[model samples]
Target: MKTDTVKQAESAQINVITEESKQVIYKSLLSALTIIAISILVNLSIRVDYVLLGSSLGETSVTETLQLIMLAVASWSFFLLSKQKPHFAHAAILISGFFAVLMIREMDYWMDMIHHGSWVFPALAVTALACAKAYQGGKGTVNEMATILQSPYMKLLIGSVILLVVFSRLYGMGSFWQHVMNEHYVRDVKNISEEGIELLCYSLIALSAVRTHRELKR
Candidate 1:
């Protein structure tokens, strides 16, 4: 009877730890966005260090570098996660592959520099198909995917991700927005909003990956 009680206590403790971890990643995500928004606002309003931070907040700037680094880290995280947890092998592999494509997309300028700009779309399509194949053929992939989709937290985050992508595309076409918004405001928002939101999203994903790795470790 004592041994059974001890086992029950251990299980409850594990459950508490898991719930705490879930809260950690989401809190980290909220903090990420708040910090990014504050930083952007400060950068835009400050005039003292304008010379130094002027272009640091723009294209090929700190945000871009951070994006590359975070996405690469996420890819590595998922690749390692797959090796560590075979039950999630297929889903992890697909996520890793998708992030790899994202990294390439983020470095589109470099591709153009090498005169390979035209290859991006086709390459992206191929990678998407490959990931789809992995999902369709790998055992247990459907169950894993269903689990993710069924999680309310994941559903909310995934929905935010989709919305963010749509917002990015619309903001990227700044000229179209000028007719509706003040030209300067449109330009400024277009310049900063996409990168700002993207950075927050990447930070969230990276933190989530770190959390997943820790959970799987135990």
Candidate 2:
């Protein structure tokens, strides 16, 4: 009877593991498809005339809207993590605040209406507030931050940041674009390349944030 019970328990454990694996696979596939679909839709919008492609990937374009949506998803996910998982609150505050700054940067075209480069002031203010919140959390904040940095999702998060801060900027350099387009250079083409990569990076970051939170919740 003991041997039979052991075998049955092992079989049940295997089944559970298999089911969990399938669920992870399904979610990964779905997330990838969603990102791909958004890319396609944004490019399609450029040809629609009504979607405002005159600025190409500018503030009014679908690409910018989608980038904001992706960043919003990431920011909201981190905010929700702070509320739902108190232990991670400090790190979440810092992360979500950073995303807020990115959102502010994206809206700089309008921000300029208030004052040229006004977005920098708000971004700096938010950074200060986030740091203050984390400081208030004391040693717990530092420990939680270490935990977050050690998370597997950190790799993806860092990769996305590198894509946004390094690869995209270098790839989108005006000199590179000018060299490529030569006499036929167009500003919209450069914007599309840079902004499209940014959108992809944002999607990755958002997906990483959601997956990390789910893992932490478990």
Q: Which one wins on TM-score?
A: 2
Residue 117, candidate 2: Cα error in Å is: 1.4
Report clashes for each candidate as comma-separated counts. Answer: 0, 0
As a TM-score, model 2 comes out at 0.80
Taken over the whole model, the C-alpha lDDT of each candidate is 0.65, 0.83
Per-model RMSD to reference:
7.5, 4.1
Candidate 2 worst ten-residue window by lDDT: 45-54
The estimated TM-scores of all candidates read 0.66, 0.80
- By summed lDDT, the worst window of 10 consecutive residues in model 1 runs over 41-50
* lDDT, candidate 2, 105-214, per-residue tens: 98899999999999999999989998888988999898998888777887898899888999999999999999998999998778767777888788788878888888
